[model samples]
Target: MKVSEKWRKVLRRQPRYWIAIIFLSLLILLALFAPLIPIDPNQTDVANMSAGPSLQHIFGTDEIGRDYFIRVVYGGRISLMVGVLAMLASTIIGTLVGLISGYFGGWVDNVLMRFVDILSSIPWLVLVIVLSVLLKPGLVTIIFVIGCFSWMNIARLIRAETLSAKEREYVVYAQFIGEKHSKIIRRHIFPAVLSTLIVAATGSISGAIMTESALSFLGIGIQPPVASWGSLLQNAQSSLQQAPYMAILPGLFIILTVYSFNSLGNFLRDVTLVEG
Candidate 1:
């Protein structure tokens, strides 16, 4: 069957696929229009400080009386941005490394695999925290740190896939037909690996979101004056007793976003397995 037909079948067969699509669509829309939304995240009303949920303030007011709802909306923008950029960066790096290592398969493979193994041995969260401390804390730094640390798993996954793919009959035929090495890898090998790459990308995005949130919660990512889910949680720490919703709203957004990506990744993994 054609690849497009297979993708259609997967979409029809997997409810998780479109469920993620809908969830993510809404989230992306919300994040995109957050500024136009009816509330100002930072606009404070001292008289309403620590207020509970009411019609006026949808998610209630924080310690300084900023609207929790708007803060959560704006926070989604930052969280999703970090997740996507980090995932893209990591996927690009991992794909290149895996392709080179698997295609070359000699001292090159050994060196790359050893490096991956060394990175895999480290506790990733610790590495992210250390890096966040060393670098200036901001959106770019968070994205870079998450992307740098997150590639090892995907690199190993793609390496395994590439090793098998390069040995396939089609690949051998391409080589025999005098196709350039780069061309063969780009055309034949990449297409073969694309499905698994999608799965890896979805997983990486969720992991990146979580990592950014954790870093922000630690007061190192997406610093104040600019809202992010993580920073919201960090700022709420002082008012946890007074305004529980301050943390709850942002935390809920994080959970929903991560869950959406995870479900999508699992669905894609299933689709790849079926196609394989």
Candidate 2:
């Protein structure tokens, strides 16, 4: 069957996936096109401080009277960007390490796998907190720190997949045909492991977002004046009783976005397993 037909069948079988797709699509579109919305997220109104949701401000004005709606939308841009870029960074590093270790085996595998084990043994949150504290807190720093720490699991998964792929008939034939190790890996092993990578990377995006949120909530992720869903929640702490929506709105977005990605990742994993 055609790929589109297969996807439609899956959607029919799992209607909840539709909700996940729609919500994620809307979030990405809003974040990408936020500049066209005409509202300055930081444009505050002293007179309208702490105003509740109204015709003028849909989600309400924040403690400083900035449009909460625009802030949330803009914040999505930052959060999503960090998630995607960090995932890319992790995926690249993981794939490269896994490819090398799996294809070469022997001493290369031992060295790389041992390094991965050492890194994996460290407490993730403690490591992230230490790195965030040591480095200057910003988007790039958060992305780099999360990416560097997040790749070990992906590396293990890809390594296992690559180990299997390298022993397959096609890979053996490629080797027999005098194909370069790099060519064999790129053409044969990488494609075989691509499905696993897709599922892992999908999950990684949500993980990165949640990590960024947690760090920001702790005041070490995204800094002030810059609005992120997490940072917005941080700023809302003082006004939680006075304006519960301040906390609710950003928290709700974080929950929904994370859930949507996770659901979508599960869906993708199922599809990949079926195909395999």
Candidate 3:
């Protein structure tokens, strides 16, 4: 079937998936093109402090008189970037670790799986908070902390998928032909598990975004002068009664973005299970 037809079929089968896809796409586009807009997120207007939404300021001016709309737009850029990069980092680490452990099995599997278990035993938020406190707070540090610690689940998932994939006919044939381990994994095992990986990765994006937001909300993720959805919420807390929209707008975006990714992930998981 043509790719377009396949998408149509999938959308027809699960109509709500279109909502998730469209919302996510629009958010991504807005974040990407925010630079083309002329508004400065941090530029303050002394006369407009805590202004309500109006024609001049759709989202209104923040406590310090900064444009709330532009700040939210720029904040999306930060939030989305963290989500995507963190997902990529976790996926790569998880895939490699899972592949090696599953393919080699025996002692290698025992060691790696045990390590994963140990990490999993720790409360993720506590660990992230401790690390955030120890290290300097910034975008790169936040991403590194989230990406490194968040891979345990993905590794477990990929390992299980790889174990089954390696037992498949094509994988057995490749082994019989003396194919290199890496080549066999790349060509056979990886492809077999790709759908599962994609689903896990999609879910991971929302997790990462939430993690970033939580850390920022606690005043440990992205610092001042730089706006993020979470940091915006932190800033709006003092003036919440005066300008509730300041808190509401960013919180709404965060909820919707996370929900959209989760919806898409659920749809992918359902489709992949059916295909399998």
Candidate 4:
């Protein structure tokens, strides 16, 4: 590698990357172990409804006096799960479609690209809303809706990467060696494209979380008794004028979560492109 290239690689592997990894690890651990935390998510304290931050309540209590801290911690699990699963669904389906279309590059490509365009033309949020309406409003529905809409970006990204990768010397050598298309793709192209996909997938999680929050804000996502940042916000919206902290608390978590994920995603994308 050239000097610039070597330096880039070193930068990509620096402590910031490790910090992002550690932050994500701890967030996930917090979500998983939410139940073990001292706060009670569902317990109603009618006497203390709409209380501001206190040592006992930490983030404070909601209208029904449900602990905001506990709800946020619990909400972390479901929202993150939806984002992850939805991204996985989109990545798997979109990667396969993109790879096949890019590799074949003929009538097959035309058909698939046309389908993608058709889907892309529709307002993604509208499409998600329509689909969610058709199905039940819950975790599975949210995942399916977000995944279906989220894949188009990945498909386009993968196609561009494949277009370049197909010209790489190794790919041609693999073909010359009489490797089957599937085998060559699986062994070579997939690994190379996977880094980009992972970076893109991280960004997609933010969108997925926002979508779920939107759905829940409209009362179509994770029903009551089930905690989600969006639903948590929804419950607090009406009382914002009176109990501002109720809305502010969950909103803070939402903002922080989205920013953290986005920062990590950008970091991944920059590092991966350099590695490529």
The lDDT-based order of candidates, best leading, equals 3, 2, 1, 4
Model 2 regions more than 4 Å off: none
lDDT of each: 0.89, 0.92, 0.93, 0.83
lDDT by residue for model 4 (133-198), tens: 889888887888888777988898898888778889999999998999999889888887887888
Cα lDDT over the full model 2: 0.92
TM-score of 2: 0.97
What is the lDDT for 141 in model 2? 98
Question: Least accurate stretch of 10 residues (summed lDDT) in model 4?
Answer: 267-276
Which scores higher on TM-score, 1 or 2? 2
RMSD of 1: 2.0
Residue-level lDDT tens digits of model 2 in 1-276:
666766777788888999899999999999989999999998989999999999999999998899999999989999999999999999999999999999999999999999999999999989999999999999999999999899999999999999999999989998998999999998999999998899899999999999999999999999978879999999999999989999999999999999999998888876765551
Q: TM-scores of all models?
A: 0.93, 0.97, 0.97, 0.90
lDDT of 3 by residue, 67-133 (tens): 8999999999999999999999999999999999999999999999999999999999999999999
Ranking the candidates on TM-score from highest down gives 2, 3, 1, 4
